[model samples]
Target chain A: MGVPFTPRANIIMTICLGTIACVVTSGCLLWFAWPYSDYERHVGWTVEQPVPFSHQHHVAGLGLDCRFCHSSVERSAQASLPPTFTCMTCHSQIWTNAAVLAAVRDSLLRNTPMTWQRVTNVPDYVYFNHSIHVVKGVGCESCHGNIAAMPLTYKAKTLTMQFCVNCHRDPGPNLRPAENIFDTDWHRGPDTPGPAALMALYHLGRRNLTECSICHR
Target chain B: MRCAWPLHVLPGALLLLAAGCDDMSKQHKENPYASPRSAPADVAQGSVEYHDTFHPAPGLTPALLQRGRSEYQAFCAPCHARTGQGDGMVVQRGFPAPLPLATAPTRSATPEQLYAIITSGQGVMYGFAQRIMPDDRWAIVAYLYALRRSQQATLADMTPAQRAIQP
Candidate 1:
């Protein structure tokens, strides 16, 4: 048979193959990196809630403790949101006539809970317990970031497996004194214990924090 | 013909692979506080109903006082200041000032009465029955008494050892 193709066909085929290879390689890289990206992880994203609750006003301005609203953080796996009545504890007296508190009043009157959108969350399979972390001297700001500074709450950290595993592997640097556990603005000071001392103080040295079952189960 | 058959099978294989890509992050299980329904009222421990008669206060110990101090700060410090002065941040922000713990009426009030006040709303103050445990209520009562004593403490009231140690 006579040559069915020109010599230019080889050059065309090489270009076509090179383009396909480049596309496939980039596609694979993007597929793997997509979930790890902050955009996909919802980090720093502000979620809309039924009410525009301001952590800045309540926490920094009014000086309300973290436990005031999230009452079960130290006792339960979940850091429970306050019931409507908890809001009424102050709103009933202070902001009684404000139009902004209409939903809170409605929730109390209707006896239906005002559904709050969770700003930070993990997958259902990951059993993250607030009580253990709080008790172990992990300050609220360590994971939640500067909550007192957030006028409107947003997801402060990417709560990915890598984020969890990084802390699980070495929890010492994150640990704070018991007094500073709830302090959102707490930072290590001159007298603050070092990593090894804190690890020993919290008795975390003996525990296998990175064990799969610790979180997965 | 053989290449055409392979292409047909390839499409089916790709479809099967795509079917497995469904997200497993969220499952059909309930997360804590995920439901919009209001939680059922908390029933008092060792009682059938939410309301219960007087229960004796827990024995006072250093640990109990420590627990009481932390609990008091968390729950009561907003309206009742950390010093029990009834001039807390919330009060400054416009909530009516609660009676200072050292006030005669509050001072003379029985532990059971203080516990009741904490468990059930007394005037504008919301009842913390749903929030604070019964044991914690008693601990707070104990702390309140301690707070009252501290507010009224004089040099004469201090022990000889405490007086000596005072700077």
Candidate 2:
């Protein structure tokens, strides 16, 4: 009946193994729980639409302004969607016979707003002002990226809180073509005005750009 | 006696691992904002235009106003007050008093102007840009107008057919 180790010793070994397994399980769980963002967190997302809209056709082909749909962006906080009437401003005469114009016509006849799925969405906690950012010289492309070239528009930047903080951390180099601040491809390398020049201009008589309270509460 | 050694060793190892992270606190530390903020004094005496992008929506509907009211209560009533008179308890307790919207000149402002202010906070209030989506802000603007009309409208305004047309 004499064993190498007592039965009490075996119980102790079992308890130790159980504790280690629990610790390992928790460690793995926490590893998965590490705070990575969701698929929508990426700036660019594509969704199925009622109609396949093409920014390339409207903007690049016909040279429509981004403001066409997001009309209130300059005088309002939002760059609101253009109602059916706005589409008809050009479409009613331009493409009245086109089969693709069904959604636009439906909105007008039914008096409903076109349901454009948000391709670019940020988290609720973040605060982004198109007006302030636009006025300050940040180009549409700075965050939105290369819009004229994009056929089907998708978000082009990682709009994470940290992504915002980095740009706000130093907003100097982001501004360009003051008049063409809406252009997506305004900034490029050494020959073009550097961030320091822009930062100096941005901060010329204004306050610091690093104030969290400026962007946050 | 030997069994106790591993237990003590495990905790010691964990403590060492934790100490290693303390060394990387350089980037993790919260730094005070490096630049000065725009002071209240810097704002123009008049309305400062901030709408860099403004697109017209489908306009307002009574249904939109109702939805806006529900959203306003959820997000804003904590501070802006249910009636939007800026009398919320949080504001009275010194949580940055919202501008009294009932008496606010904002009530007389255009829809776009009202939309701008709500989208991008007027003064002490920061923009609801991220908190409330744009459509919701537009809806809230519609509701704000409804609230003003509810206050200013009378039986006379409604019974216009009974009265003579204004000269």
Candidate 3:
């Protein structure tokens, strides 16, 4: 009877501990889950645009060059979006009445440019140039994956800093001949030189590709 | 008194954290080209050449043909070689080559016929009608004519400096 504390005190303490345990368990789960989530990387997630332009059909089926639409890729920092007039050139002749192309037709009618949503994006702080990478013999498929096979166009690789570091540390595997830059299915053949030889050919010496100034302005 | 404050703060912290879980599913905007505002003028559009309804433009000038050459390289060089020999990289890969634009029959083709072929394709060649504007088609046709003419040029066609450079 000398004990001042009752059984109710023990019950309260157990409940508080149980709640704390539950919270800690869920916190760990969420921490691991966020990176593995589908939305974080946007892999396999197709963005709906004014026109559901299929890179698969055009690049693979039709066999058109990437520069046909991304005209400034070779000369500029941006692989710029094709102007409305480029779409109108073909739309005005065929599929002129398709409901799906109504936005495209409306742009031509209203004289407005069509806006395409960007699929793969790096942070604004990071400065990436398309022309330099292209001139240096990096194939489109290196960063873009097998774009010819992508029917709906999604972010194939996570644009994380770690991902960038992995490539910058060693760009040999991603290197190809300048002539074969547009060849999506190109791979090193048995007769072809090794990655070291290719690196030598492209003049990619043992320089640090992952320097802070390399990407960060 | 046994950490009553921690219990009170825990649920509130959890509620705040749950609220911060952003929904990135709707990141992309719908109706990409639905904007009705007047489109910004394109610099390349200024180079386009449209054949008038009644009168064809006079003999192709060097400037006009140069614009045509660039336009052709951008749009036609993939399927039609820069030489207009229908030996583009796409054809070299395995695509069935279209008839060379510098052939005798192609040379005989009227500007309108060449425009139609570009707009409505032929054989296995798919139409670029939607992608290439009418004015650019005329530009390509003019360049094609120039290419054919250059193929048959004689020493008389060259200037003194050009003749000196000729092999």
Candidate 4:
């Protein structure tokens, strides 16, 4: 026999090693990025509900306040969903015969609760409180997006650990004045207080908002 | 045998990675409204069990009035206009208009009676006893008094300080 190996074998070996390296590198990148993607986070996805309630019509068209139905937002951890009675408060008279409101009317008549699908949520391990955020002047639009504009309510934010930590690290820029906390369309105006002033106003100084127990426990 | 050690480590590495996978997102703990039957059961009409008479009205303070104003805006302003004209946005959208707060019957009604109407259904309006807390209901009553006074006030009703600021 000649030699056990040919000169061409070195070139073939190099090619195989290069291909493997490329595949492993790309696979690592994709694995790390998968959780952060909006697709994986279910952002902008509308959940199917018993009744397709329109936030746009009730919030924008009718000019109803968010607290009108979510009455416990400023007082409780969960911004409680409205009972069937809340729907009947208006539907009993205005949309009494509409086909879409049949489920609502039936719920009231049967004394069953209308099951509303939760559109936005964090993981069970995360203890997020709506009252604390609202009390601290975090605008509803900050996490919920332009709620008055969504015809069918959808998850507007990623609600991932990175998303929560980003705000927790620097909360001033996300805060609003007490009066503007509920205004979904509010933006920082020339007269609006700067982040530092708002930080002082809300008494956010000296507190470790990013402490592990602050959100995790 | 030395090369086989890498193969042995592979299984251990895989087990380490698998340890990270868990059902933490959907833990066994109960969250708010998690159950289909989370809502409170409806009380029958004219049920004496629904009486809130034990929870007396809180004393009037500026803070109480402020809380009342916000609570009223949230709970009452949908059907009863902010100005107590009974032509709120919900009314404009075809819900039956409530009687104006400045009207004879409402204006002459005592605070306790107003509280009762809010606590229980009055005519077409549904009772808000389940939604509004007792303290907040009292606050709303106080705010309604302020709204009525504001709507019915004459120029003579203004104090010197208020009159001076008037255009």
Every model's DockQ, to 2 decimals? 0.47, 0.01, 0.12, 0.53
Give fnat (model 3).
Answer: 0.15
Q: Compared to the true structure, candidate 4 yields what TM-score?
A: 0.89
lDDT (10s digit) by residue, model 1, range A1-217: 9898888998899999999999999999999999988899899888888889999999999888898888889888988888787888889899899988899999888778778888898988898999999998899998899999999999888888999999999999999988889998888999998989999888887978889999997
TM-score of chain B of 2: 0.58
Winner by TM-score between candidate 4 and candidate 1: 4
Ranked candidates (lDDT, high to low):
4, 1, 3, 2
Please give me the DockQ of candidate 3 compared with the native complex.
0.12
lDDT of 1 at B149: 82
Cand. 1 Cα-lDDT = 0.86
Per-residue lDDT value at B107 in model 3: 72
How do the predictions measure up, each by TM-score?
0.87, 0.48, 0.60, 0.89
Give a tens-digit lDDT track for model 3, residues A63-155.
Answer: 677877776677778776777766654455556678988988887676667777778776666778898888777888887888898888888
Per-prediction TM-score, chain A only? 0.94, 0.76, 0.82, 0.95
Off by over 4 Å in 3: A1-38, B1-41, B47-74, B77-99, B104-167
| Winner on lDDT (1 vs 3) | 1
Which has the better DockQ: candidate 2, or candidate 4? 4
Return the TM-score for chain B, candidate 1: 0.76
lDDT of model 3, residue A193: 67
